[model samples]
Target: MKALAALALFLLALHPLSSSAQVAPAYHARAEQLLPLLGKDGGEKDFFSDLFLTAVPVNQWRALTADLRRQYGEPQSLGSVRQNGPTAGQVEVRYRRATVGFTLVIAPEAPNRVIGLQIVGAKQADDSLIKVIDDFEALPGQTAFAIARLTDGGPQWIATRAPDRQMATGSSFKLYVLAELARAVEAGERRWSDVIPLSHKSFSGRLLAYPDRAPMTLHSLATTMIAESDNSAADTLLLALGRENVDATLSRAGHAEADAALPLLTTAEAFALKMPANASLRQSYARASIAQRRAMLRDHAARLDAKAVDIGTVAETPASIDSAEWFASPKDEVALLDWLRRHGGEALPIMAVNPGIAPADAARWKYLGYKGGSEPGVMAMNFLAQAKDGSWYAVTGSWNNPAARLDEPRFVALMTRALNLLAETSR
Candidate 1:
């Protein structure tokens, strides 16, 4: 009897210990099944390769694997795979140098393809890279803002919203239009010096109506449109180019979200629509026939709405603008800036608008240019600057405070902080 009781007690204890041990290995094996296939042929290998090449070293890859093993203990072999929704497995993998701590992912295909990967990090760190994650996981009291800043070499970013969130581009959209026109000149579709007729109807707000017979070159119109944020100049240029051509240009330049059909300007719907504040400009607009003026306004308004608005007053409700499906990812935006830098004289007049570039810095950076946009509740800026060492960066920001009003200085300060953060991170 004594032997029997002792044997039963031992069995009971053994059962619980066995169950606990079994549980861990079961979870670990499941993780192995979900681990991303890391070689060159894998779907996400290129992304990993780029990240590793940019931030880590080839020798470090083995070290990373060893460290993972040491910390986690022996990994279990994969078991009979079971499907979980579209995923075949799931796991959390750690990388020492990644901006985020561990990467949590779900593998949907056999051989464990990555269906999703979530990076874990502090709010600021997450904003610097996985901005969409930050926005989705935003806690109470956190306000989302897009940040753009110029670093010594170029531009960098941190977003508090999804990367694709399309805020109004304000006058910044003019940059795209101007680029298109410039390209047209380059392609022989239009000449920079070609005289375009201006009319009384072309004037609005601060832009005085020009005499109907006045003529200006395409180059002058583009310069005025960007440098001075001249609406009439932009409208006239758009009319000459035609909406279809402008859209085609944007598409060619890789701006898939750009819309070409928006009218030039009207009150009800326009994005960052503006004209010269000069009285003479206003008079020129006022002197035009009411119908002609309205037609001009209608066209201008359409163009503004189509482009997205990122600039203007900082104290009022931003104009109700629709979001765009197209956006420039942080990586792509940087590439575009690099392309512009490589082709210098092509963007001369527009580049000249930036007052921030000093002569000495210009020589060191080679080419640096920036555009800023502000509206009642939105603020944004984009820059492409080259470094003395030949490196370049593209920095951009689009911020909106819809629930409360923030002063311009405060807003600018916020943007400055974002820029500073980029500089600190890059170094």
Candidate 2:
């Protein structure tokens, strides 16, 4: 699910083109139904999308909507709804003092389907920003966190509980993957245009959904891996650049416990390790020699049935998530982002493809790049932005609660505020 987290949102608002056709009554009803679900968990909002235009799976949809939940808390009522083009439109949904808009891309034909929905002009004030961060720190099960602004040479603090402690960071580890690939490109070992074959299909990615033998350029893989946080693309690029190379890159990027996630697991390998039913299999992989890790990963992934590993189902038991998952601290992420600033300019354009921050906040900066990852109990949001003033900043946050399912919307709200706090610094 980390791959799909923050995957929605077009960044650019979908302004309606000229349309003489009336907005369908059913579509209006669907938009009306969608209003109440805006700020809360969006279980019912799933019904708005037309199957023809929006073919995202249910689990993936939830993961993408996590961004909206963070940005838009709850809709009090719709101010108005306007038809955009013949098929899509924008709805003004008010949330407390905030009046956020969302573009709904409706289908051209039957059912007046909703193919897309994304928060528009989402913004927050300086006051509640502190409150949300404070409340999140006081959360009973949340872990140590950090929300600091990394300017030219300062981290004007925003929030922290135990900012130094490391926790499982899920797919946020792909930052190192990108760094290693960049290093490889600099060394002339890989090219952005090099076409590579897809090796394995994994949950939570567009690449896996593509037909077998589809070749993707190294540049395409790098961008999409950050853009959509594509898991298969991450794993594919990881293997191509050599796992050890990525490990070294993490170390270079200042990962405090670089070896903690030693021989960092791919989405395929990590997916297999999460099964409580495969306890023995997990132990064997852990105990296996370093030389045998790849073979072990392939052998295990090949045997695991994809249908059996529903993220919604297996989330109940994080058998190996805590101990076996990727680990990072806010301090470590800040260091990584700093390293990215010095060495990862190539990554900025790709990361900017998904403006995971509030649209209003994002508008304050010349560039904004984000990567967030989550499972059931763990979540991480890391940002690297360059303000219009030509200064850079990084805000990294993680919440780990192995005890129960996380309050994901709450987590997203707090993290979005962290970004808002950074946006304020840009002024």
Best by lDDT: 2
Per-residue lDDT for 368 in model 1?
54
Mind giving the per-residue lDDT tens digits that candidate 2 earns over 319-368? 46665578888888888887777777577677788877656457768888
Q: For each candidate in the order shown, give its overall lDDT on alpha carbons.
A: 0.43, 0.69
Name every residue pair that clashes in candidate 2. 16-84, 39-73, 39-74
Residue 290's lDDT within candidate 1 is 38
lDDT of 1 at 55: 43
Off by over 4 Å in 2: 1-129, 151-158, 281-319
TM-score of each: 0.47, 0.71
Using TM-score, give the best candidate's number.
2
